[model samples]
Target: MKRKSAKKTKTEKLGLIKNILLIILSFLISVALWFMGTFKDQTPVTRQLIDIPVTIVGENVLTDKNLYFNDIGDIKVNATIKGVSTAIFSVKIDEIVAVIDVSSYASGEYSVYPTLQNIGTAVTTTKIDSVDIVIEDIVTNQLDIALEVEGKPVRGYEARPDLAEYESTVSVTCKASIMEKIAGARIKVNVDGKRTAVTTTTNVELLDIDGNVINDPGIKLSVESVSVRLPISLIELN
Candidate 1:
């Protein structure tokens, strides 16, 4: 009986050892497979990165020549990159930069190809959409800067326009085509809940014919800001 018990205990120990070995072997096999799949350069993969901004290189050259793009239609493009599966999966959208060199081109309409930069050596750009760029001459115009009064004075109070003091005119430099579209420039001042005269300064903004705000960085303003003085008077009702 003692011998049988000893044999049974030895068999149990051997079974435990075998189970542990099988588990270790399975784990090793899995790790080896993962490493092979991650590092191996298999077939090429394609990825489409969208809305990549097309950088306008050498734009200062145009500025020096008093030329600018009238309409840089769709300053963005979709890039198709091809590379090994690992490289494609590792690439980020920001890693790619698209640029178009307009330094050599003058004021005219032209179709140009955008060059890609910062792409990994393992990856190659398979395709990119062409861009239509219209270059126009830059022009400076003198515009009357008007004051825009926002909100109303307190009840029984009136605002007087005679006391307002500000620069009546300003110089605007922008693309000739854009200059033709601009209606005027104005500085916005708020008089909401005001019981007395108020004086303040504010920045200037350009507006289109329809009163839509024009926000173009290339448009340079001689006076970016202005000052305004508001004189309020109390009205007595009979």
Candidate 2:
């Protein structure tokens, strides 16, 4: 009877061990399935193409040592990018840009900083190779100069201070399109052969109805005074 009881107890112990092993195996298998599912459905972030508007704010002063001719006004830039779908979706257009320096350029081509960042993902980023930019020349000209005349020519020859290579006033050139409008130039001339003695300051009109001069109205010309020396022989004849 004792031996039979011992065998039964041993059988019970074996059964319990088997049950525990089975439970552990089942738990491991379930855990493995869960891991596999997660691996197969990996969520990735992908980038999207979008236009990001940027406005640059700065001061314009030619006297400033760092100021550049091309650095005036605002500049526009275009950008595009691609990344993980989730990352791209979460990315804000405003967060992906950087400022560019145009202070060194007086007049010519330029390149602004491109943006690179990972919006939603820890491993990827949307990128722009480089911003293609061009800085134009900024030019300022003085207003028209007040005209003045001096001296006189011969008696027979009259003094024509109005004869200009271009217009009388100094025309200013700015933008390329505006510069094309500059035409005509003129200068005060005194004919000594005509004969006369005179000196006086005059207000010279530098521009024409067409906004041009005889030569390049866009240029500035300086005039001191009008003078003419008339020979005694010519003066007597007059």
Candidate 3:
């Protein structure tokens, strides 16, 4: 009877040890699963994008109303974005588009909000609350086109931009503010190294009264370019 009791006690001790081992293994597995779940890219992320282009919509409305844009603030925007890690990290700058609608607006300055497009399932907040857009009534003008020479001809050659014959006049159209800044319009010609005459079409350039180049997109020319006939001759020999 003493030996039987001893054997039973040994068996019970073995069973208790097995149960404890099983519990420990289960607990370790649960901890490992928790760690995998936490680190498996299921986290949320936030990021910022800069210089994303803003698409201007409904500008044709202004044209239909005989109006035009004198100035539009930055065409690019910066925004903060938020989403799941994979989606947010995969977002591209070009794929993001900010848009502003001016259809309901008239000829005046407006502070407007822009909406986002193409950023999938991501929430966005723009850095700027509003963008300023300046619209005005359109004006038209008819001006004779001429040539403005840049760069001297190569040594021993002479270029006569003045003698260049292009008799076609162009129609200039813009806002009143831009119209006031324009004095004349001419085609820019480069005479840097011309051994012969140039008979090609060139883009028209707008100039202020001081002969400084006026680079405003608001200035619209009826004809973008005009035909030219510049004469070149040998002036000296080296």
For model 3, name the residue pairs that clash: none
Number of the top-ranking candidate, with lDDT as the measure? 1
**Which 10-residue window of candidate 2 scores lowest in summed lDDT?**
224-233
User: Per-residue lDDT of 1-238 in model 1, one digit per residue for the tens?
Assistant: 9999999999999999999999999999999998888767677889898988888877888878988855465578888999998888888788677888887888888887788887778889899988888888999999998877889999989777666888878899988878988999998888889988878889988999999999987789999998788788888678
Give the Cα lDDT of each candidate: 0.85, 0.46, 0.80
Compute the lDDT of residue 80 as modeled in candidate 3. 76
Residue-level lDDT for 196 in candidate 2: 41
Task: Indicate whether candidate 2 or candidate 3 has the larger TM-score.
Answer: 3
TM-score of 3: 0.48
lDDT of 2 by residue, 39-134 (tens): 654565445445444334332532244333332234334545444444456677667544544444454555556444434344353454345554
Off by over 4 Å in 3: 1-44, 71-74, 126-130, 139-174, 179-238
What TM-score does each of the candidates earn? 0.54, 0.42, 0.48
Candidate 3 lDDT trough over 10 residues, lowest sum: 121-130
List, in order, the clash count of every candidate structure: 0, 52, 0
User: Between candidates 1 and 3, which one is better according to lDDT?
Assistant: 1
